[model samples]
Target chain A: MTTMADRTDATTTVPTEKLTLARALTLGMRTALRHDPSVLLMGEDIGRLGGVFRVTDGLQAEFGPDRVVDTPLAESGIVGTAIGLAMRGYRPVCEIQFDGFVFPAFDQITTMLAKLHARSLGRITVPVVIRIPYGGGIGAVEHHSESPEVLFAHTAGLRVVSPATPADAYTMIQEAIASPDPVIFLEPKGRYWDKAEVALTPYGTPGAGLDKARVVRPGADLTVVAYGPTVHTALRAAEVAAEEGTSLEVIDLRTISPLDHDTVVESVRGTGRCVVVHEAAVSHGVGAEVAARVTEECFFELEAPVLRVGGYHTPYPPSRLEHHYLPSVDRLLDAVDRAMAV
Target chain B: MTQPDVLDTVQLLTPEGTRVADHRYDPRVAHLDPAALRELYADMVLTRRFDTEATALQRQGELGLFTPSLGQEGAQVGSAHALAPQDYVFPAYREHGVLHVRGLDLTDVLKQFRGVDHGGWDPAEHRVHLFTLVVGAHPLHAVGYAMGVQRDGDVATGDPNRDTAVIAYFGDGATSQGDVSEALTFAAVNQAPVVFFVQNNQWAISVPTSGQTRVPLVQRGVGFGIPSVQVDGNDPLACYAVTAEALDRARNGGGPTFIEAVTYRMGAHTTSDDPLRYRDAAEVAAWRAKDPIDRLRRYLADAGELPQQFLDDLDARAEELAVHVRDTVHAMTPPPAESMFDHVYATPHSLVDAERAWFRDYESALEDGSVR
Candidate 1:
C-alpha cells in the first residue's frame, strides 16, 4: 500500500503500461498520496463506492479511510473544507462529481480558493486541487455531460488544465497536486476510457512543460487548434484532410487558463490559416479565445480569418441529440475547408 | 414587537446587576476573581469605544464603511476570551470584539473598510483568519481546519497546551445557508474539534430572525446531531461560561458544540444602513435597556470591585484608545498600484506576468510622453 511512495522518483526504466485515462488518474493520485504524507483525497462516495465513475477505484482499500475520505454529499462543504485543510498545511485534492453539478461550489472555488492567496498577501497558500469531470460525449443525461471549463478558466486566480490522453492524465494530476497555487483539474469524462501507454516512473517535474501546447500532427497548409475531447476530432480531421492533398497541422492545448499562445502563434505563422475546435458552445467559449489570440498574433500570416467549430448556442440537448450537438471530425474538416478556401 | 424568548436561555448575570448560578456552567467561570471580571468589563468598554470611533470615521468619510459591533460585545468578547492561544478563529465581518480579544490591531480592521487592502494581518501570526464577508461560507473551513487538527494528533491529548480546537463565528441568517449546514454535517461525522458560535443579533440587515428561521437558532444545531445551548448575549459571565465548556469539550474530542448567543443589533447593520427604515423606535429602546456594558458595570460597582480610581482610569483608557484609532486610520496610506499584481498565484502565472509587464511599460510610457 505504501510501496508507491518509494517508486515515485525511482529509475525511469519502468515499462510502459496500457491503461485508461481514469486508471491513470487513480495511479497519479496514488503516487501523490504515497509520495507526500500531507496529500489526501476527499469527495462524495469516493471511498467504498470508488466514485460513481470508478475513477477512484480501490484507493480506499489501499490508503485506508482518513487519507481517502468519503465526505458528506455537499459540494460546497467539500471545496470549503479543502481550503481549510490547505490552510492547515495539507494538500487536499477534491472531486466535484460532475461539471454541471459544480455550480453549487462555484462561490467557494472562484471567491475563496482562487483569491485567498492574493487576499492574504502571500501569507496563506491554498494548495487545493479540484478535479471536475467535464465535457459531453458520454450520451448520459443532463448535468452529466457538459463543458464548464471556460467559466473556471475565466477566473484569474485558478490554474485550469485538462488532460486529453492517459499519459497526460498520469502526469498532470501529480503536477496539479504539487502546485502551490489552487488548480482546477478538468478531466475529460468523454475521454476517460481512452487508452495510451503511460510511464510508471516520474518523467519530469510538475511544471516542466505541463502547461505547454503540443503539436500532435505536422503539416503546412493550415493549423487546427483543439483541446480535451476535441483534440481527437481535430487529429481525425487532419488525417481526412491529408487524403485530399491538403496539409493540415493539429495542436493540442493542454492548459486552458494560462493558454500556450506561443505554440499556436508559431504554428499559424507557418500554416498561414487557423481553425479552433471545442465541445463547448461557440459563443464566448474556448474557441473564441483561441480564435481571438490567433488573429491577434498571426494576423498578417493568416490567409483567412480564424474559424471555430463547436456546439451551438443552446443548452445541452437530450442524449439523443448529442451527436448533433457535439463537434465532430466532419464539422472540424468543414471549418478547415473554409479556412483553406479563403 | 420584540422577538419571542426561549425558555432555556442561559443567564449568569441579569440586566439589573443580579448574579444567577447554574450547577453545570457556574463552575466553569467560578475561578475568575475580581481582577479578571474587571478586565472583562474593560474589554467590553474598549470594544464599544472602538466601534463608536469606527462609525464616526465612516461618517466623516475617512472609511468606506463600518460594521459596528456595538451591542453584541458580551457575545463577541466573552466567547473570544474563552479560546486558548492555540485555538483558531474564523470570524464574520462584524466581530470587532473578537478581533480585539485575539490581539488584532484596531487599525488592521480599518484597512479593509478604508478600501486599502483586503486584510493586512498575517492569519498565521494571530491564528485568526481574515473576516469572511460571505455569510456561512467560512464555517466549513473552520470544520475542515479542525479536522486537520484532529489528524495532527492535537485533539483529546491530555496535555492542555498541545490540544487545539477551532471556532467559527457567524450570525442567525447564516443558519439557512447550505454551507453552514454542510459544515455541521462534516464536523459531526468527522468528530472534529470545533465550536459553531452563532451570534443571533436578531437582524440580517433589515430582515428579522423570524424571516430566517421558524424555530430558535439553537434548535437548528440539534437537528444536525450537535449539542446546542442558547445564552443571554448581554451577560458576559454567562457567555464566558457556556463558551468555555464548549471549548473544553471540543479540545477533549467530544465533537462540535453550537452556541447561540441571543443578542441585539442596537446600531444599524453598518454605517451605510438605516435601521429606522424597517424597525420601530420602541424595539430599539427595549434592546438598549439591556446594554451589555452598563449591566457589567453595575455588577462590578455593586460588588465594590469597581472603585472610583478604576472607573476613572478605564474611561481614560477608552478615550486614549479612541484617539489612537482615529490617528492610526488618518495616518494610513494606500499601497502602490503595482502591488495589486502580486500574490495572485504562488507560482508564476504567464498571463498575470504578461499583464504586469505591459502595465509597467504603459506607466513608463505615460511618464516619458510616449503614448501621448
Candidate 2:
C-alpha cells in the first residue's frame, strides 16, 4: 500500500505497473475514500456482488458496508438519496448498474442534483458523482449497451467526463469525486478490461486535471478528436492511417462538458482539418458540439470542413447488429480520408 | 374504494365550529395557550390574504401565475408551526403557508411567480428548501437529508435543541410518481427521521384522487413499513397535535411517519387552470363548507378567544400584508441577462465565462452600431 507521503513526493520515481481499467477505477475509489472521510460509494449489488462489472470488487470488505453501501434496486432512489447525502456534506459516488438503467434516475440527476447548487446560488453544493458504464460492442442484450452522455453534457450545471485509459481512469475518478458540483462520469464498458501501465501516484497535477484534453498521438496531417470507447478506436485508426500515408493527430477528450476547446483549436489549426467520433447518435451528439466549435474557431485555417463519424440516429440495435450500429475503426478512417480528400 | 370514515379522520375541531377531544392528541393541543392559538389563527388568515393578493396580481398581469393554497391552510400552518428552528423543510410549490410560518419574506415568495427570480430567498438562511415544481421529487430529497441527519448523529441525541427532523411536503398527484414510492423505501430502509406530509386535496389537475390510488393515500406508507395516520386537514388543532407528535417520534430515534392531511383544493390548480370544467359547483360548495380558515375562526370565536378587537386587528394586519406584497412585487426589477451564467457552477467554467464575455461584446457592438 502506498502512503500519501510517497505518492506526493515528486523526487521519488514510483514503479509503473500494469492494471486493467476496472482495477484502476477500484484503486481510484479507494484512494478517494482514504483521502476524504465524507466519501462513500452507493449502488445496488456494489457490496456483496462487487458490482456487475466487478469494478467495485473487494471494496465493500476493504472499506466496510457503511462506506460501500448496497442500496435498494431503484435508480432514482440511489441518486435522490445521494443528493440528500451531499447536502449534509458527504461526497457520495453513486453507481448505476448499466447505461440503460440510468433513465429511472434521470429526474433526480437532471432536475434535483444538477440544479441544486445553482438554485441555491452556490450556498449548497451537490458533490455527488454518478458513475455509468456506457457505449456498445459488449455483445450484451438490449438496454445493456447504450451511450447517453449527450443528454447530460447538454444539460447545464452538470460536468460530464470519461477516462479512456487506465492512467486517466485512475486519476480522473478521484478528480470527479473532488468536484464540488455534480458529475456524470461515463465509463466505456468495452474498455473495462483493457490494460496499460499506470503510475499509482501523482494526482492533481496540471496535466491530470479532469477537464484537459490530451493529444495522445501527435501528428501533422489531420486531427481526430474522440472520447471514451471511441478514443481507442481513434488511436487504432491513427496507427492504420500512418501506414497509408496520413499522419492523424489523435485527441482524447477527457471532459465532455466545458470542453478543452483551446487544445482542440490549437490542434485543428496545426493540422487544418478535423474529424470528431463517438458512439452516440450523430445527430445532436458530442461530436456535433466538437464539429461546430472547431468550425467556428478554425474557419479560416481549415483545409477541409470538420467531419463527424458516429452511431446512426436510431435506438441501440440488437447486440448481433451493434457492430454495424457502433462507429468502427474503418468508419473513422473513412471520415479521416474524406477530410484529407477535401 | 369505500368513502373515508368520518371517525377514522383525527380531529380536534369539527366542521360546525365545535371543539372535540382526542385522548392521544389532546395533551399536545392543551400545551398551546390562547395567545399561541390566536397566533396560529392569524398565520392562517395572513397566508390566505397573501395567496388571494398574489392570485389577483396574476389575474391583473402583475405576475405570471399563481398556485393558491386556499382550503389547505390548516395543514400548512399547523404543520409548519410544529417544526423547530433547526428542523429542515422540503416543500412542494404550493406551500405559501409553510413559507410564511418559516418566516420567509412574502415578497421573496412572490418574486418567483412575478417572473423575477427562480426562487428569491436563500434556503440555508431560512432552513427551508426551494419550492420544488416537480411533483414527488422533493420527498426523496427530504428523506436523503434525513439520512444525513442520522449519519451526523443529529437524531437520538438527548438534546432536543440539536436533534433534527426533516418534513417533506407533496400532494395527492405526487403520490403516484415513482420517486415518492422510492423515497418511502429509502427512508424506511435507513430508518431516517423524516415526516412525509401528503396534502390530499382530492385532485391532481383534472384527474381525481381515485385515479391516483384505489386505497386511502395514508395507507401507502403502511406498505412501506412506516406508521401513518389520517387527519382532518381543516382542523388546525388536529394538524398541530398530529405533526408535533410525529416530529417528536422522529427526533427521538423513531423512524419515519406519514401523515395524510385530507383537504380540498377550493381554487383552480393555477392561474392557467379552469377547475369548473371538470368538477361541479355542488362539489365545490361542499368542500367550501369545510373551509380550513372558517373552521379555525369559528373555533376561536366559540372558545371566546376571538374578541371584536382581536378580529379587527387581524383584519388590519392581513390588509397591511397585502399592501406590502403589492408594493414589493411592483418594485422588483429584472435581473441582468448575464446574471443567468453566474451560479451554474461553484467553480468557474471556461465555456460559461466565454459565453458571458461574448454576450457582453455583442451588446456593446449593438449599442455602438457596429453590428445588429
Model 2 C-alpha RMSD vs. true structure (Å) is: 2.8
True contacts kept of each: 0.84, 0.70
lDDT of 2 by residue, B236-303 (tens): 88999989988988999998988999999999999899998999999999999998888878887888
* Per-residue lDDT over A1-342 for candidate 2, one digit per residue giving the tens place of the 0 to 100 score: 222333365765766789999999999898788777788999999998999999899989988987899999999999999998888789999999999999999999898888887777677899899999999898999899999998998889999999999988998898888888799999999999999998887543323676789999999999999999999999999999999999999999999988999999999999999999999999998888888998889999999999989899888999999989888999999999898988
Candidate 1 residues A151-186, lDDT tens each? 999998899998889988998898888888899999
Candidate 1 is graded, for docking, as high
Candidate 2 regions exceeding 4 Å error are: A1-16, A202-207, B1-7
Error of 2 at B141 (Å): 0.5
Interface RMSD of 1: 0.7
Candidate 2, residue B248: the lDDT equals: 89
What does the TM-score come to for chain B in model 1? Answer: 0.97
Candidate 1 backbone collisions, by pair? none
Per-residue lDDT of A19 in model 2: 96
Candidate 1's C-alpha runs over 4 A off are A1-12, A203-207, B1-7
